[model samples]
Target: MKKITALIGSAQKKATYEAVREFERNLKSHTEIELEYVFLADYQIEFCRGCKLCFNQGEKFCPLHDDRDLIIDKLIHSDGVIFATPNYAFHVSASMKNLLDRTAFFLHRPYFFGKAFTSIVTQGIYGGNSIIKYLKNMGENLGYSTSKGCVLKTLEPVTKDVQKKNSLKIKKAAARFNKVLMRQTAPSPSFFRLMMFRMSRSSMKEMLNDEYYDYQYYRKNGWFESDYYYEVSLNPIKKMMGRIFDYIGHRMAGMN
Candidate 1:
């Protein structure tokens, strides 16, 4: 049985929570999964102080001590993760944003490779689509193979028609997520992701030293010489592109 964790940003059991519940049900129809819902509001999380300790040194050196690591532990143990939030003022709720802020170190040293990730955004009228896009990007930055997320326009006084529509959207999203979750091997990196890894690693090799955490992490992972994050056969064209990206990165590092 696969363990799936859904991080719900809302405090109340409302639209976003219900949407995730429906998603869980739909997912279970496809395969056996143990779904866990994590309500961020129930945990004690300190707002980030922008000290950059986690980025420069390590996450263990952060000043604030809270439940951040506990949440991260759940993610680490899960096969898939779902980021569900209600659109508050055209963005994710405070709880969701705070959680992401706390885990900002993942942007520098991503750790969720080979995991499945998707987003569920609930809104009254507009802006949920953009939030879905943002969360999808966030998942990719965290090294998850992300499925395109879904947004449900959940207005007040929920009618049967709206419920039906939301159910259909949730079902489709769940199916897509399940397929990615069941995959036995990691997917090949896209051209853009390949470029990002090559360029970033090349720049780190040229500009940064062992004093920086990123440089040390890259060196420890052997990213300085690897073609990509994992072993994969790249075509001749992509191999050439990778070299060009490396050259561009080296030039950029020199300019800085």
Candidate 2:
């Protein structure tokens, strides 16, 4: 029997979680794949410190040592991985991005390389494709099989009717994903295909060296700094700034 791990991440405790849970439940009904879900909400993981300690220094695995290492250990052993996250500001949520950033520790590790992986991006209205593209690149560049991944977009106000339809769509997608999961081994690539793979790898290496993720960690005293790390940086400075500006504007309008 195949084993699967579903990495569920959410920042807002929103409706999308229900959808992901339903998708997992649906998958359980069909395949013999043993599924394990690691919900970020339940765990305490520190943000990546950007020190590259996991890669270069080789000191204690990750720069920010916390539950992330333990969570990753479980994911490493699973035959397949499923990343489920919500879309925020036209991309994946901060919690999900932090998790991805921490994966730099395993960049050279064989655990994730060439492993089957999929993704689910739940959003209120738009940006599912953008988030999905981000995850697809992560899979391809990190050596995970990209063929099994998928993206799902949900309606803004999730009602019963929307939930029913969305659940059915997710079930169908999961079924399709299970087919790929069953066949763990990849078929041999022809000479031309092999050449293409080589070329793709070279290109991906170049792009990854630039590393575009902007991850922020917070101190225990609610201060923002690179070295200060927390499991989840809830209400980041950017979000807080937006709220502050909104509050000022609302007060001025009231005075007017």
Candidate 3:
């Protein structure tokens, strides 16, 4: 039996809870695989301090000892990790964010090195794709073999129609994840480590150089800098003024 750990990352509330319940219903279809569910709402996790203790100083333990340790242990022991969350503001909920922050404990740990991962994201409005992409990127960064993602958008009170659609998607995603986990072969650590190190360096440089850094670079390249700021500063005011004019015109037309 393949051991699988599913991390339920939504904050325990009405809509998110409903989505979770629906997902659970779908998961039951696969009775052959041994499954365990870990809920983030039940635990108290702290923000990562950026201490780098797991990699730089200590014996691979996160600086803040909290519920994250147990979660990490479960993930390490499992052959597959399934991340499920509700999309909030085009990303994951606060609970999911906090849990992600805690994963710093396993920065250099071999437990998550090349383990299979699948993501399931539910969004009330738009932007489910963004949330799925974000989780998938994180999974890959942690040396997890990522499977196909599951996305749900515009979910309200869980109706039977929505449930049926999501059930099939979740079941298929879980099956695919299990198949990858059952594969005995794992990725090479030394090669992955070197590639990850290089990627990190490049990504860090790009991140540190945001708008301000871009402005500087463009200025150096003889691109007029003041014009860029002028456009950025004027666009919002222009949009606001345009809306005001449109509203006034509509009222005037109604009066006529």
Per-residue lDDT of model 2, residues 154-207, tens digit only = 656568786776777788767866766666455343333233333333333333
Instruction: List model 3 lDDT by residue over 1-256, tens digit each.
Output: 5677778876565554555455545545554556677888898788778776555444345567678778878987887777888887888878888887666433333236557888888776688888888888788667687777788753666688877877677777766766667666654333344334333333323343333333233345332322121122334654444444445544544554
Error of 2 at 34 (Å): 2.9
The positional error of residue 95 in candidate 2, measured at the CA in angstroms, is 1.2
lDDT of candidate 1 over 1-256, digit per residue (tens): 9999999999999888889989999999999999999999999999999999898899999999999999999999999999999999999999999999999999888889989999999989899999999999899989998998899988898899988988999999999999999988878788898888888988888888999898888888888888887777888989999999999999998999
Score candidate 1 by lDDT.
0.92
Q: Which prediction has more favorable TM-score, 1 or 3?
A: 1
Error of 2 at 43 (Å): 2.7
Q: Which has the higher lDDT value, candidate number 1 or candidate number 2?
A: 1
TM-score of 1: 0.98
Compared with the true structure, all predictions reach lDDT values of 0.92, 0.60, 0.62
Model 2 residue 96 CA deviation (Å) reads 1.1
- Model 1: residue 246 alpha-carbon error in angstroms: 0.7
